[model samples]
Target: MKKIPVMAAALSAALLSVVMLTTFSGCAKKPKLYLYNWTYYTPDSVLRQFEKENNCEIIYDTFASNEELYAKLLSGGTGYDLVFPSGDYVSIMIKQNMLEKIDKSKLSNLVNIDPMVLQKATYDPKMEYSVPYYFGAAGIAVNTARVPQYEKSWSIFGRSDLQGKMTMLDDMREVLGDALVHLGYSVNTANPAEIAAARDLVNSAWKPNLIKFDAEAFGKGFADEDFWVVQGYAEVVYEEISEEQKKNTAFFIPPEGGPAYIDSMCLLKGAKNVDLAYKFIDFIHRPEIYAEFTDYFGFPATANIPARQLKKVTPYYQAEELTNVELKDDMGENLTLYDDAWLTIRVGD
Candidate 1:
């Protein structure tokens, strides 16, 4: 009788131990991801699809600007599995050691990315830490009907007649760089004298003619004909313009040159769910998903052959036209010169 009781107690204890182990294992297997990205950048349906297929919940967050996003990630100590940053910011983040080294072995769909984009990017020489998300050019959008006189050059922003009827980007680097390029200097010039000269040009131009120096509001102003000419992103203007207005609203690549930027996705260094992040990235790289993104976002994707085929079905695809688009190289420490020039332009002297 004593032996039987002891044997029964042991069996019960073993079963209890098994149950605990199984419960803990199940908890350990659930995957969760956190993503930080730009506002209105990704389609919610795509995110839903990812969640359904992977059985992982993705907490998506947005920032209005790259600088804001950088500041938050750097100072907040918030853990994000994935983030999207512009090409130049990627270089900055990598230098700060904030990004994780991507494991190519885990990313089978990485082959979908264009070799050219990977080769040309200055931030991730070998694309070690980031994947290209979108590419766009900065240019002038003018309402020809309002202006009557079409001006194609960058100098049009300085026209005296257009006083209080023009808007320029509030972005320090882009606006300053455009001014520098207008003066025939390198956009990435580090020479203090050169930057100062660029500042003078922009300051002198700002005087009574400037309507507002802004980024976000400028695009809407242009579309509404509140401004005759505005300096802004090509993609945003392209999407905002009505088919009728698009004919009258001309988009130009300044003869003097303008900024070209690439937005890319990167993994944070201390991310707890790195594997899940890679899985999510690979899922987006699939042809169908890429198509959906390009259709809604109206920017060029970096995926190579698949993107080419996907473009066929969507009006947003511009594969042939994208060939001529340029990309901004890392300006290195010269970025400070651009920022300083911007301040000088806005505040004078």
Candidate 2:
């Protein structure tokens, strides 16, 4: 009486499996918090900890430069819940209404942010559209053991001796900005003539030290003594080196007032899950969490001033270098000029 037909029993099992699969699939999926950030820039442990604590999945993506991030977001329907764009792009996004205004009421951790950093976010003067995350200068990292007679200037990229043993960030603006600084022009220059001159300088002069332009090395080349000089984010090069490597490698902003950049997290205008995005940002601003990030990667955190004061998070550059750093500003309609110039630079024209 208990034995059913074999085919009938198999059919019952298949039905039950379908029901179970459908039940699990129908259950609310983890709220996805899409993050567009710098490639290899965030600590994996920190992201894992956040996911474990919040019971959410962080869908992480990366951009090599602010220009890339802006182009994607500008095309619209990016569906990113949050994005980390540098200071000038943040300003442009704010003006272009590409980001959601910060609801300060939801950000109790706002107090953790250093006023100096927040004040410098001139793109959203009231801190309405963005919150500062990493604050630092974009400059040069040198392996003194390999290139002993280094000048603390962007001019060093032009050194014939460094031929085929150097790399700069793959970003267009970063490359062009350093060339401008080397040429005694401003990083934020909107002048077409100035921008063209910077392009010419890069085309004629800065191309000597060329292994390849890279943004994802994580200072591996520098640490391994592959690149005698690397020009990119200080956070990437500064902390990735070991205690022994620190003896020879040094990070510094040029005295000519090299480009300074601030990276901030902001909600995308068409975010699918705004509340989850806010929660993630709030968690990131927590002093302990922020410390884990900076301590792990040696990045400078602006939101958690306490993190900057942590024993592991020491100062970056000398006082003179710090004083000379300059932030890039929104170029407005003139942004088109830089874009065209960047295209020319890439084409080797």
Candidate 3:
């Protein structure tokens, strides 16, 4: 009877020890990080480098548009530790208190960022809440062989002769914002009347000239020669052109002014691993890493000095042309006006 009782006690103690050990192991495991960003925005090699350096597992997710990312985050389908959103959307998120203020002490490499980028962001006045990743201009890319008079402006897309030979981005904000700017109105205008006028201009431009309104098709279409002129993001079109076709393809920043956007890294309020997130941001901001990104992706870096040095290797680089660039500012309540105008343009009202 004594032996039986002792055996039961030993078994109970062993099970308890096993449970305690398992609990401790689980607690010791590294935290997982989730990142939500644009499609093909970051190279996998960069991600692998980050993962190897940080000793953590990373889960990356991609979205096609900023609106799509907003919708997904709002819907609460998944939780993300970090996200890369455009300056306007970052401003919107900050206004909504969706982002957490970053501690500058955590990001030492932030000092390496370009002074121009730091000064120009309208969303984060001091860049307190966001770190700029890349900057790009919405411009026209023309197959010079197909369109002889392509050097003009957004008016080239309005030409009747270019009908069915032009492609525009499907993004409402970019498409409508540029149209608003081209029509001599503010891209961030809030007035209903101004928005309506811009809508009318875009609708009229679309009626005769649009081959299609697409987000991803412009680059491939330009390469295939299915479209001679495309309203394209600088990076996408630049990446899509072949070495030979690249000679024929030229990007034009509309003389009337067009929308420029900065994609930035931000932390969400409910982020679980804030320390790791900052470390990742710092890793990305390293000059060599930033240069690698710009060289491979064809997007201009906010780390302008390092990017400028890297650009010297490419014959296509033109620093003078890119110097006078601008950035998109928050529209606040005017976002509604722009959306309504976009709807009107698309629905014919």
Best by TM-score: 3
TM-score of 2: 0.78
Q: In candidate 2, what are the lDDT values of residues 1-349, reduced to their tens digit?
A: 7998999999999999999988787655757789999887678998998888888888899987787899888786498999999888887887778888889999888888877666666666577888887777777888888888887888888888889888888777778888887777888888778889998887777765578788789388887778889987666676578888888877877888767777889999888899988988898888888888876665555457776555365645533354556678877777788888888767666
TM per model? 0.82, 0.78, 0.84
Q: Candidate 2 — which residues are off by over 4 angstroms?
A: 1-30, 74-78, 161-164, 196-205, 208-220, 223-226, 235-244, 311-323, 339-349
lDDT of 1 at 104: 82
lDDT of 3 by residue, 1-349 (tens): 4455888989999999999999988757967779999998888888888888877888899998788988988888457888999988898899888899989888888777887766668678577889888766777888887876655577776788888988888878778777677777876677788778778877876646888788777888888889888887766777778889887877867667767777899998889888989988988888778877776766555455665565423523343344545566776665777777777767766
lDDT of 1 by residue, 29-116 (tens): 7678999999888889999899889887888999988879988987885789999998888988888898998888988877788777
lDDT of 3 at 298: 64
Q: Can you tell me which runs of candidate 1 are displaced by over 4 Å?
A: 1-30, 148-151, 206-208, 238-243, 302-305, 312-335
The candidate, 1 or 3, that scores higher on TM-score is 3
Candidate 3: C-alpha lDDT: 0.77
Cα error of candidate 2 at position 123, Å? 1.0
- The runs of at least 3 residues in candidate 3 whose Cα sits more than 4 Å from the true structure, single-residue gaps closed, are 1-28, 311-326
